[model samples]
Structures are given as C-alpha cells and as structure tokens.
Target: MALLETLSVLSGVGGLSFGAYQYYRAKSDEKRKQELNDLADELNDLRRDIDGIVETFQSPTTKVDLSHQLDYCTKDVLAYKHETGDNALVKAEKSNGGEKVSNAGQALDLYKNGDTYPRYHLTLESGYTGYESNLVYAVSDHAVYINHLYKTLDKLQERHKGTLEEFSPGLYDGIEGLMDDFVEDTYTNILSHRDGIKVNPDSHNNIEEMGRFLFFYFWHYEGITKELESLSQLSDKIEEARTTILQASY
Candidate 1:
C-alpha cells in the first residue's frame, strides 16, 4: 500500500511536468506567429509608401527631400536604426510580456556603414543644380523610400517560408531603375555647364540673357513621362504582391 501511494505521487508529478512543457511550447508558437504578423504588417506599409511616391514625383513644387539637409552619406534614410527600438503599433511578443520591442522604421535604419549610402547621397539637393525645381529633389525621398521597400522585400523573402515568394520580383528593380535613370539624366543635363556647354552665370553668359534657352527643356525628361504612364502597371503588380503577403501568417 505504501508502494502504491508512492507510485501515484510520481505519476502526478510526471503529469505536471508534461503540462508545463506543453504550456511553454504553446507560448513559444504564439510568439512566432506574432513576429511573423509584425513582419507582414511592415511589408504592407512599405508597399503603400510607393503609391504616395508616384504622386509626389508628378507635382511641380513637391519637396521630396527631407526638409533639412544633412551629409546624407553619414545619415541616410535607413539611419533610423540607431534612433529607436520601440514600436507602438504591435507588441514585440505574442503575449504582453515586456521583453523586447520592434519598430519597422528602426529596423530599416539598422546600419549606416554601407555602400548604399553614397548613391543615396547623390539624391540630395546638391545632387544637381536646380534640383529643387526639378527631378533631383523630386526623386530624392522617392528613391530612398523605394530603396527601403526593395531591401525590406528582400528581408521578408529571407524571413518567410513560402505566393508571398517574391510575387513581383522585377517590380522593385523596375521602379528603382527608372528613378536611377532619371537622376542620372538630370545630372548630365545640369552639369553640362561645367564642361560640355557653358550655362554658368559668367561675364559672357548673363542669367537673364539665357532666357530663350530656358532650363525648362531639361526637366522635360522623356523617361519621367514614360514611367509616369506605366505607373498603372506598377500599381497592379504591387497590389497583387501585397494581397499575397496579407493572407500570410508565419
């Protein structure tokens, strides 16, 4: 009878141990699901930013660069990493266990020491003269935002298992390529004054005297208008991609 009691006590302890392990596993699974959801939500927000970029590019007085200028190489758009780790949107864990938090903006800005910043620096106001009135200023943030989206999508691809599998692979590259081409052309046209054509305000060529040869012709970039028309295609591809990501969980 003593042996029976002892056996019963051992069985009860074993059952409790099993229950504790099950609880831990369930909690762990929940955290994983929450983390996946957070990534999906982040991916969606990045996609949405592109729509706004399309509009901003078309406007005449649109100020696309950061309101304040900095040496963008030292502080590119992704520089938000060193800024904060607190995300107010979603909790870091599945449960309200205050352990670690995440912010999408901060995640994108995770590092500054990279090769990408130099290209980003070229998009600043100094990228081209008269950028404020033309495409350089217009393309600055658009480029950064698109770069963020591109890098974010690459990250999600690595993070996830499976339609969400790079639904539109070339879409990111296409938009980025167009922006790059436009920026390149703008520089070539604007900087022609230095070596190719003399448009500098010199003793020979007065500012008012160059009126007939208006720089407005330079802003009429064939590529910008061409890309503008194709914006619909860009929308369709990304909308489909976002749909796939939205349906995904973990």
Candidate 2:
C-alpha cells in the first residue's frame, strides 16, 4: 500500500513540471512574434518618408517667357492725284527730279574722277613727312577698294544681263552699250593704277604698307552687305514665281 502511494505522488510532480515548461515556451514564442511586427512597422514608415522626400524634390515651380523684335525700311508716298481736265499733264513748279537721278549721278561722277576717295595728293604737299607713310597706305588702300568695287560691279552686270536675257531682252539690249562703256572705263583706270604702282615702288614705304593698303581696300569693298540683301530678295521672288508656275501646271 505505501509503495502505491509513493508512486502516485511522483507522477503528480512530473505532470506539474511539464505544465510549467510548456507555459515558458509559449511566452518566449509570443515575444519573438512581437519583435518581428515592430521591425516590419519601422521599415514601412521609413519607405513612406523616402517617398515624400522624392515627391517634394521632383515638383516643378518655375516658368519662363521670351520675345524678339526686328526692323526694316520701306518707301513712303505723300500724295497721289489723277486729273481729267484739258491740261492733264500738270508738271511741278520746281522739282529736283528723283533721288536716283540726282544723288546716283553725282556719285557716279565722283567715282569716275576718283573724288570719292581721300585727296592724299593734296595732303602730301603740306610738307608733313610723318604723314607720307599714311598717304602711301591710303592711296594703296583706295586703289584696292576701287578694284574690288569694279569686280563687284562686273558681277552685278553679269547677273543683270542674265535676268534681262530671260525677262527684258529689249531693255538689256538698250543698256548693253552703257554697261560696256562703264566696264571699259573701270578696266582702264585699274590698269593705269597698277602700272603706276609698278613704276613707283619707292612711293610705297615698305611691303607692310602695300599689304595694309590691299587688306583695307578689300575689307571695305567686301563689307558691302547691300548686295546680300538684294540677293536674298531676288531668291525669295524666284521661289515665289517657281511655286506659282508649279501650281498652275498642276
């Protein structure tokens, strides 16, 4: 009987020990699960903060505006009237003709006589030896400018002749003689000056002076932007005419 009672006591003790061990294991598992959840929440908060910073930096808040201006010249007409009376041809009491007739003619005359250039010859007589070098340079420069101007004129004449051949043959024929005369005069002047330079190399101080004169002459003549403007206008007109002809053909 005593043996049976001891055995029952030992079994109860073993059961109590197993129940305590199970409770301790359950508490440890719960603590680990709580730590994992905390880590996951912190990671989500960090990602949200990074996203907000990115959005703030990527926003556009500035704007810009730009503009430009251009200028040009055009002819102006003051008055125009038509008369149906007996004296239909009422001329002006006093008129200076046109700008081209007056100014262009004067310019042509000056150009022909070399008056458009500086009067270095007169300046040379002032006994100013210091300016002799400058005078030589000036003369050389003027000669070069005239030569380039003649070449440019020749080109313009050729273009004018080609255009006349296409559209205004009669006008071309009438102007041909005048153009020939102008060209001949220009050539004669150039050859005479070139020959003069060869004979009077002493008149030029040095090779440097000759070079300076040639450069300045070409620079001035080549600086003529008016021809470029005229060429651009001609190109535009030609394109317009071509387009019109193509459209008509179609």
Candidate 3:
C-alpha cells in the first residue's frame, strides 16, 4: 500500500512539472511573436519615410529652373517716347487712329495676354541712348520658379521638422533661412524690382536702379543654383538614412 501511495505522489508531481513547463513555453512563444510584430511595425514606418523622401524628390517643384520663360512688359509707350526719339503709339495712331492700341498700354497689342508681357532690353551702364522691346518669351523664369522651390522646401520642413532637426540642427535652420531669404530678399527685392522697372520704363530712376541691380540679380542666380544642388544632396542623405535603418533592422 505504501509503495502504491508513493507511486501516485510521484505521478502527481511529474504532471505538475509538465504543466509548468508547457505554460512557460507558451509564454515565451507569445513574447517572441510580440517582438517580431513590433519590429515589423518599425520597418514599415521606415519604409514610409523613404517613400516620402522619394516623393518630394520627384515633385515638379524640384524640376524648376531657368528654362521657363516669363512674359513681362518692359517699357511704357509714352515713357519710351521720352527715352527714345521713336514714338510707338504715335506710329500706331498714324497707321490706324489708335484702333490697334489696347487700354492696358502694352506695346505688344497683338500678342494674346496670359502671364506674358512685352520684353524690353536697356543698358544704362554703357549709355542712356535708347531701349529695345520685343514679345519673345525666353529664359529668366527665376521668380516663379524659385518661389515654387521655396514653398516646396517649406512643406518638406514642416512635414519632417523633427526628424531633420534631430539629424542636423544647423542644416534645418539654414534651410529655413534660405526659404525666408528667397521670399524676402531674392524674390521680393530682385524680381519685384525687375517688374517695377519693366512697368515704369519712363522713370529714369527705375532704369538706373535696374542697371545696378543687374549685378546682384546675376549673383543671386549663382547662389540659387548652388542652393538647389545642396538641396539635392540633402534629399539623397535622407534616402540613405532610411536605407541604413532598414538594413540595420533586418
């Protein structure tokens, strides 16, 4: 009877031990699964970041350059008469009682208007001899193009402000300053000045001012080109970071 009781006790202890082992094994498996799920979520987030960087790089904003053309008025008709001996309005009136002249005063009355304006070329540095005007649309689309790039960078900064700041605080600040400068200094001062000169061609001050401003305008062009190249590098860096994170996680 003692032997039978001893055998029963041993069987009970063995069953309890087997139950504890099974419970621990199941818990371990559950923990491992949770860890794997967490890693997958992290990886997905990194992939999304990568996609965002690529999308920004692909944006039309990045394609902006000096290739586009701006149609802008260069000289006022009456103003041109004072600067140059030739009077375009008088000639037009002589031809047909001013029937072809538009109230807007654009010299190129025949050209369809929609963001295009009369083109003018003047050089005060050499001499205040005369002015030339045309309707041909070519390069110097800097104003609107730079504005688009500035806005694009602004959106990108807002989207990844925290990440960018964490990666490189100075760079983040520099980009912020660049956007502001492009709007306030480059776009506002240079482009606006050009427009002012084009519209007020009769003003001697406006003409003279543009002569001096041309130097700065060309200089700004070089600066903007360099900034764009830097921005391209930044985009590549972001992509590289995303790739590194993914590789490390794997």
Candidate 4:
C-alpha cells in the first residue's frame, strides 16, 4: 500500500515536469518568431525608403541636370564687366546684343579674336577643377542602382506573399542584368559580380521551386537593406548638389 501511494505521487510530479518543459519550449518559439518578424519589418522599412526616393528624385533630377547641361556652357566667353557679374549667365539680356539670353547657349557670349582681349575661358564652378558641378554623372549612376533596386524589390514584395517565398525568381537569376549593372569586359583587376550570378533569380533556372523567395528573404534581405540605405544617402547628396547648381545658375 505504501509503494502504491509513492508511485502515484511520482507520476503526478513527472507530469508537472513535462508540463513545465512544454511551456518553456512554447515561450522560446514565440521569442524566435518575433525575432524573425523583425527581419520583415526591416525590409518593409527599406522598401518605403526606396519608393520615397524614386518618387522624389527621378523627375526633378532629370529636369535639373538637363537644364544645367544645356543652359551652362564652359566655352570661352567675352567676360566683360557687366552691371552684375555672376558665374552663370542663364536668362540675361546680353550687353553685346540687346536681345535677352533665355538659355545657357546664349549665356556665354563666345569670344571673337578681333573683339575682346581679356576673354575668360570659364570652367563650370560646379565641377572639381576640370569637371562640371552638375548632377548628370552621379545621377546617372544613382539611376541605375535605384531603378534596378525598385524593380527587383517591388517584384520581391509581390512574390513574397508569405508562403515560404515560392513565387519570385531566385536571387541568383541571370546575365540580363549583369551587363547593365556591370560587365567585366575590360578584365582590369578582375573586378566582377562573379558571386551574385551564382545566386537564384526567378530567371536563371527552369525548375520551379518553393524556397527561393524565402532564401532571399532570409539571406539577401540584409544586403538589400544596406543597398537601399546607401541609395537614400546618395539621393540626398545629389539633391544638395542639384540645389547648388540651381543657386549658381541664377
């Protein structure tokens, strides 16, 4: 009778121990899920940043850069003392000709050999020493980066409809983007995107798989976030340069 009673008590103790273990595991799993959820939250933040940059940067950058290019000439102009001597000669009434100069080609009155002696061969103040201080080149690079980023990320968002990431191409997709993103044609120092090509893009393969989306979500997402952040910073810098150009133009 004593052994039987002891066995019953032991049984109850064992069941409580198991219950505690199960509760601990449940709490651990919940913590892990929240951690994984943070990854998604970070990616969403990057997407919003990318979209905001694309919206604000694209059209205005083009207009500002284009206007700067066409309106500001670096050629030798008859830099005579006008009423107000400013660097940029955009939209002015020429002293040589009473006609108003509305564009950049008209800004710098080209030096004629017989006419002016102290002709100034002006370099655009925007560039560092010999370069122009415009947003054209930097904006070009930014365009490529951000454009691909937008399309790729947008597609990723569409494909990542939650179910283990099956819909989109694998991140290691193909050569189509490789050429424009870069091509190692010169073989100079062997700088190449050799590794990225090895990854999945929904493109490079034919076999339909279920895990490619999640693979990128888990692995490539952080790198992508970094890229978007860099682009955002670049966009702001470009905008500042654009503002400088505008101020100089006037």
Top lDDT hit? 1
Estimate, for each residue in 61-81, the C-alpha lDDT of model 2 and write its tens digit: 110110000000000000111
C-alpha lDDT of candidate 3 relative to the true structure: 0.38
**Tens-digit lDDT string for candidate 3 (155-184):** 545555564444445554664454444333
Instruction: List the RMSD of every prediction in angstroms.
Output: 16.7, 35.5, 15.5, 23.4
Estimated TM-score for each candidate: 0.42, 0.23, 0.31, 0.31
Stretches of candidate 4 off by over 4 Å are 61-123, 126-250
Residue 36 of candidate 4: its Cα lDDT?
40
Deviation in Å, model 2, residue 208 alpha carbon: 62
Backbone N/Cα/C clashes per model? 1, 0, 2, 17
lDDT for model 1 comes to 0.43
Error of 4 at 164 (Å): 7.2
| lDDT agreement with native, every candidate | 0.43, 0.31, 0.38, 0.32
Candidate 4 lDDT over 1-250, as tens digits, reads: 9999999999999999999999999998776555444434434443444455444333322345422332233121112112124332211111222233332222122111112211111122232224454212111222233334444444434543342122123321221232222211211111121122111222324211212221222123223444445555544543443344333323
TM-score of candidate 1 on Cα atoms, chains taken together: 0.42
Off by over 4 Å in 2: 60-250
Candidate 1 lDDT by residue in tens digits, 1-250? 9999999999999999999999999998787667556656654665565565565455422342432221222132122223332211100011121111132222223312132521221221122233352112112444455556556656655665242444556655565455445445443443332222222222225322232122223233556667655654666666676666556543
TM-score winner between candidates 2 and 3:
3
What's the distance in Å from true for residue 133, model 1?
18
